[model samples]
Target: MMTKYKINCLIVFISILFLHSGQKPCFAQKDGDDIVIGKYSIIHSSILDEDRLLYIHLPRDYEDTQLSYPVLYLLYVDIYNYFADATITTEKLGGTGEIPPVIIIGVANTNRYRDLLPAKIRGRNEGGGADNFLRFFEEELIPHIDKFYRTKNFRMLVGPQAGAVFSLYALITKPELFNAVLSENPFMNPENADFLYPRAEQFFKNKESLKNFLYIKCERNERPQNLEFAEKLSKLLESEKPEGFRFKAEFKEPSGYFIPPIPFGEGLRMLFAEHKLPENFHTNSVKDVISYYEALSEEYAFEVDAPSHMLTFEGDKLSQQGKTKEAIELFEFQLSLYPKSLNALMRLGEIYRRMGELQKARQYYKTFLTIRDTDVAMIHNRLNMVERMISSSAACRIEQEIRKNGIQAGLRKYQMMRSDPNNELYFDESEFNAMGYRLMGAGKTDDAIEIFKLNVKLYPESANVYDSLAEAYMNSGDTENAIINYRKSLELNPDNNNAKEMLKKLKKK
Candidate 1:
């Protein structure tokens, strides 16, 4: 019991335990998994002339994978390590049959109030640093990410709370940042809400390529102002006839992490939901909206793509107009007729997953995965489910062992780097995305928005950014602005039914 070998081993074990315990546990713990957290700094803001420190999360497979991966950059609080634990935890929890495995970039705030505010300010609460912050994101942060990681052009952004407000500003002021945006619990000042809608119309008045996704959520715990603001945002987005914007919105009670799954997932589903794909949806919002557009095409003696250019004046025309069952049937029929259609297969898979038919969802998702050559942002999440469902003890053991060693070894290095204050941490995009979502949960909206906008600029070809920006705008009560961005988004992808619906509502108001 007192041998030197045993004593040495005991000391090492105790040291590891102590170090791990001291590390923050922001996320919930799985049975045998660990989250790697670290911090880094860069000169991101030119106006402020200050170094900004950011937190990063590395996923379980980050070190294991050599293939280039897509990135999701998340904005967070102003502090160097604020919400660091929460960010890691949220991503871990969301990975379980919820969202995707993403790199999280948590930007710590040196001056959140200054950087996130869209207009000039005199008081501490008011901010005017938005433009400079935007510039920093577009020029420095994004380029840094591209250079430092094995990243494809595909990217997404995320923000929450006041960060959602800042995100809206970025969406309207500069629409060419990221391909997709995910925003949670935005703050919509009444004055700001009024300013949003008209600005939206102006932004999208000129036709532009707008392939983006905007996913927004409003928690019910806040004042009536929040809900009312969300409604206004919905109206504004619904009015515009954008081509590529996919907008999905919902109001729900706040959950602890990364927004609640019910509404947030629903929004995600709507924004990216696929239709039957052999006749793939176009970027012009013409072929992908709904049957109404198809019927209108014939009645107006217009081309099938006519709706791509036409302004949808009456978005509510479909209210109580179609049966859910019939809608499902049509989607299924399209898939049956066009087996190679990406949109159809994705929709079918999502529908099956939602209906708790994991097997059917797996089949469609597998098919989609084979054809999906671009970013598989949510692939890891799906893979986790597949692995769990396979029921192969050998396979399970192998994966478990790999994960254990991976997480534990990563944790060890992570602690060493964190302890060394002089050292910096490196991260890819998936880690950044998880960080962004965690920042949202902690009510750091401004930083999150900046992160997301940068993503849009980096990946202009993606429609997901527009969708994410629209959600951020809605949270901020900048419905007018949300609508304009949504229109711009629709311009990129005409098939997004969610954006079309939101645009119709905005027009009605």
Candidate 2:
């Protein structure tokens, strides 16, 4: 029989085991039914001279979408899972247009005190590996992540407690590594606080501008020492901040030693405040929204497109308001930005059909078919109705001409018809390019040249058109004209690699 003290210790041990087992695993299990939050990977860090595990949570559509996402690197994930939960929730909100999608990378620690502390104390053995740890992230982990993931240049760092102190150290020491920093109740006692405060002040003194977001929050009922340090640091940053450095500090009622999700969510909202679209935006012109995001892209230093669902909703609202022309234009503009949007194509087709434009409706519906394979029955029925309408209308003559003559002659006839006040025949630049390529493939070099020339006339500023014309001229042995057009193409877009190469070859000849 065991003694009473031994029995009590056994019970405590069993309880601890039960609690730990109840927590979520950091990696996916082999069972097929369980949902995987993230995967586990290892990095061999030469700076730290150790192998470290990385817990990575990618966006849900990461596997399917070609889009890149900003990264959020969180520290001390092994001790607290709340940060991961907060990151995942915030990312979901971002998907709903509250912010921008972000990839979460959780760094598991080998030695918490040694890796987090900035320097060694007089009698401490395990408290001065912070520089090596930061070097590990900078030299090894970041490059590995970038190579394996579709990541944008924007990055954020987040931490709590001692990890938070490390975060601030990285921010002050290597400001260029991350675009944002979130530190929750950083461990700032007198010694480290004195060391860090001056460094931050000196950093700001030298820099003219710092385009980064920094948020530091502390608990209201925290230890007096920690709270005092937070206040001092916050005041220093507020007083000596450089231009373009977005900084915020907050003191909340005590939650726990670990950061609660509420403050984390608030920090994320504050950091990406510009990413959200205005709630009261109401416009019939899509250009207004596009221009708003274009300006925001310049501010954020990343290209951002208007959300597709927002565009669709606004277009539908415009259509319901009897602004069909504006709705059509909005949908067309959406297609121009995102050609893969089947919703825009379908909406345009329906709007044209409602306006009794059978030919235009048929064109959009056919494009929808080309992009997607679903809705076969509805598309075929609509196409048949459009064909019936076209067969009984005067547009039948243009279809007969296209069938009787070649594409070039048909295009010429269409142009002639369009010149008449009664006819509305239309041809786009893509149609001309396609026909030109087809003619070029069939040894009709002169016809191809004329088609490309017509395209250049239609779109004078298009470097692609001039480049195609130059290529046609080269094929036809007209080096002088080819050189002229190639030079024009280079002037329009100096980065046109094909034109540069062809020009070099032609000049060599």
Candidate 3:
């Protein structure tokens, strides 16, 4: 809820934060327990000669990935309602993937009159220091954030009432400071109204065009003067809109509600209308997406690289189109940009596995495991399947060599490789048993027998290898060899019930 104080009693904190950016934010500090949604960061401003408190909230995945984000400078953080609403609203907007995720910098107010008011009144607590405050953001706070944090050039400004007034002042005074402005319920006093219009006229006359965004909303129970200002400003902006400047104004009083909304979510959305992808955007090729973001960067006046999820989805589209090479390229490029992004990692692993690049698939899947252990079972299953594929590949190669040269030559080579314990192809009884069963399933009884025999050489002391060899022999109808191996298996482990039963059956046969 907004305070019902008169304009002269206006003690406001301008809190502005939105989503999406990619440049660099300056370094700052953290202390005290006022860390709510974000921590209380202190930026010592030389311009104001005071320690300014900034509450900074970064993207959810900022710590995990290498992607930079846009800056959303929020005012009115001390006003819990505005700060809470903006936080929730921006999250919802970013969730839609329409607008990129932004680093929210909510600046707390020290002096409402000195920072938020542009024109001074007759009282001692009168306004007129808004420029110095803006300088604090431009010279001290913003640079501090940019230097310390990963930020983009597309910054947004937002505030309410006096804070909103300051937002508009920043919009016109320092047109290049922020790319977008969301001003809610800002009413003009006689002094600021006199100053703002003339300042705007001069600025508009001087600058050919300004690429920016403005969304103004006024609710009912607001002063008639506030409604009047909102209407007049809307009409004025309509006629004097600059090239590439976006504008939207909503007067909820006409809708019969004077409720002070926590923050205007729709205002942020309209300002970033193009940030959301179209319905069929995923249907485009990777190059098209790259170009889309490239052009968006150009339009936003910043280097707006496509976010990791965008790249992941685009790469998936490529995979679906039978464009394996393109998918790999896009996913690889995503990894290069984001570095260990789960989306890219998982996509690359799945695609490589599908393409039968077992080693590559294993590489990606293993790396994915290190980043996030949430899907341990699923990832482990993929790794196991990859290992089986690799083992099968080695088995087939050895089989071919046996066919080309001699069984003894292949056996000698296998023995030589097995001497090195670190060989990836080295396996225990379970893998050998699995590999042998795969060959048996393929109706390659001779190959299965040869694989089982290799397993015997690897785990000669283990009963399972001999039991598996016995089954392979029985499958090939070599009753004599089956009986021999089964007897040996039972000798190695007398408690081998399967071996005992198989020996009895073969003896009867």
Residue-level error in angstroms, candidate 3, position 134: 1.7
Model 3 lDDT tens row, 1-509: 11121111122222322332331322232443232345566777788888877766766667877778888888887664555556556665675666777888888888886789899855565789999898888888888888999888788898877788899999988888998998888857777777777776666656657788888888866877777777878887777777767888887744454536634578766766677667677544567777888898888888876766667777887888877788898999888878878778888898766644567899999999887665367788988888776775555445445557866666776776667676666355665566567567657788778879988987898888999999999999999999999988999999999998898888897
Q: What is the C-alpha RMSD of each candidate to the true structure, in Å?
A: 29.3, 19.0, 11.2
Judging by TM-score, tell me the better candidate of 2 and 3.
3
Highest TM-score, which number?
3
- lDDT tens digits by residue: candidate 2, 255-279: 7654454356778888867666677
Instruction: Name the runs in model 2 displaced over 4 angstroms.
Output: 1-32, 121-124, 256-259, 325-509
What would the per-residue lDDT of candidate 1 be over residues 1-509, giving only the tens digit for each residue?
Answer: 11111112344345435545744443445665532343454545554687776555554445544434345666664322224433444343333312333455656666665777565443446666777888888888878777876665555666665566677677777666765677766655554555555675677555454666677787777557656776667676776647766776777656664433223345434532331122333322213455544663343222222111111211112212423234345455444434454555665565555443456777888887775634555654764564454443222222233235743343354345446677534322333333334334445555445444544654566566666667566666778877977887899999988889988987787
Whole-model Cα lDDT of every candidate shown, in order = 0.53, 0.75, 0.75
Q: How many pairs of residues collide in each model? A: 86, 0, 31
Candidate 3 is scored at a TM of 0.69
Candidate 3 local lDDT, residue 327: 88
- Please state the error at residue 256 of candidate 1 in Å: 9.3
